[model samples]
Target: MNIRKVLTAVLPVALLCLAATARAATIGVILPESYPSADQAKELQLGMTLALKTWPGDAAPKLVIKDSGCDARKADAISQEFIKAKVDVVLGNWCEINAGADALRAAGIPFISSNAERVKAQDLQLQMGRIELNAGEKIAADLRRQTGLRISARTSCWMDFDAALSERVDAVLCPVLTMDRGRWDQVANTYGAAFRKPFTASSARGYAAMEVALNYLRRAKAMKPAAALKETQATATLLGPVPAADAPAPTTALQLVFAPHLPKLNAQQTQTLDKLVKTKGCACPGGTLRNGCPRDSGPWGELPFVVRGGGTPAACAKAINILEL
Candidate 1:
């Protein structure tokens, strides 16, 4: 065997492989430091890392993580750092992404947000990509047009009963988190094992953002990164299939009814409740008010509320309004 010749040939190939690995796409992730709690930020980071590990690729992209502290100035600084690093893509929560959006757009680096909040008009003009769970604004607009339900307040908190079920409001529009129970349980178990804590919606969101970034990179090999991202079809992610650019956003937001708001009914009132539940369908899967809400111990559980489902938000609003009246 020619040992010298073998070493010469193998060393070059090894160096080339290293070079290829080094050239893999760099992904920048900005997470909150103060507003949402440091533990949540850590969970988001862990979710991103897990996504990279599970990604079906020989060379995983590198990650450059920064803490925005939910501060605009800090977020802007982090964006500058990402720009200097020449990251192929960026992902972050709403605060950080919105604060640094202008700089990132100017840099021509594609960025995506996992925020479920309604996107601002300016952000839309900037062409910021978002994978959000809440479409409360859209739903509100739709309900307003269809049912003439007066919306008094909008909140992101799922358990904001005070605001959501206020006496002045006809209906509360809020985003709901939906996932395949089996798939979610599997992810939760794995995540809990790795982090020794319960998996959260934030964790799922972080994972989804990374998946989208990697997908964009994959498509960027053939076309422009922005176009690639824009063209990305619905992806079957941990949270579920993210809707394509033009596809109707998933049904995530629901109209909630404050159970306590309904006056104590006589036989006729009870009959009306039964008829409403039968025709409109109960928001609480536990059946109707007659059966009682089985799972009401969480946030809104403090006040006892029912979700209005199985019909349009406007219809739900009308029914609840009639019941209250």
Candidate 2:
């Protein structure tokens, strides 16, 4: 071969090798440190680390974490910082994502979160949470069957329950994590041991978000900054595939869905229902309600629920019982 020709071929091959070897990308993570989600932030970091370890690759994404404090002002400021740094992709805001979402989108950076309710899904805003298809009707049916059923909407632990009920008339829906209590406890215990705090709903979600982000980067080939800004409408994650679409947010406030008539509940049963509401949440095999409410007895017998606005709690409970039937 001529010397000039040989040089051309060798140079191209060497450049290709160099590009392949230096394929690392940067990922920015913003967590609410000032407020309660500090622990969740730590757990999120842990989850990302675990995902990276599990998914072997030479071109690992570098995580650049920043604190998007609980306040909107702080979140906005942190977002500005991420923009200045020109991070490839952004993940964060365990709290009000509105603080940072607008700025990030304007800058064309991808922002992913487990807390879907905070920000409406938009151009570059992505949520890692899932939606329930038909929760309200089902709940009403169950309540009706068990007349005199004492039920209360306990939303303290359920994340997306209110959102689910939106499809129903005169009410919002909430979700109860019916996943296997045993497995969840085991996982929470492990996380607590590692992080020195009990694992929480936020933590599990943070972990799931990281896994989802990793999945997107891997599938989308966002190893370069330009590629990172390439917004994805939907991506598969550890929890499930999520799309950048408007999702329901969690609401502690409730709306009563009135039935034609109320199911009669004796005072004693009403008291039992009150007790169930005192501790809101559902206990099932898997942290999910794929099947109906797990059959049980006493305070736990019927599924725990909540009603709001219009009608008394006792009245609403009776109405729900009538609806369930």
lDDT by residue (tens digit), candidate 1, 183-230: 778877878887787788767767767877787788878887666766
In model 1, the runs with Cα more than 4 Å from the true position are 1-22, 95-97, 118-172, 246-252, 257-325
- The top-ranked prediction according to TM-score is 1
lDDT over C-alpha atoms for residue 109 of model 2: 79
Q: For model 2, what is the alpha-carbon lDDT of residue 303? A: 34
* lDDT digits (tens) for residues 1-325 of candidate 2: 6999999889999999989757676778777665554555566667666556556565678877777665668778888998998776778755554567778889977777655333444666666543323344355444444435323333322332223332223233344332345555665666666657766555556656666666557655635433443344455444444644654423222232333434456766455444333222222322233223323333333233434322333344444453233
User: How high is the lDDT of residue 261 in model 2?
Assistant: 33
Against the correct fold, how does model 1 do in TM-score? 0.62
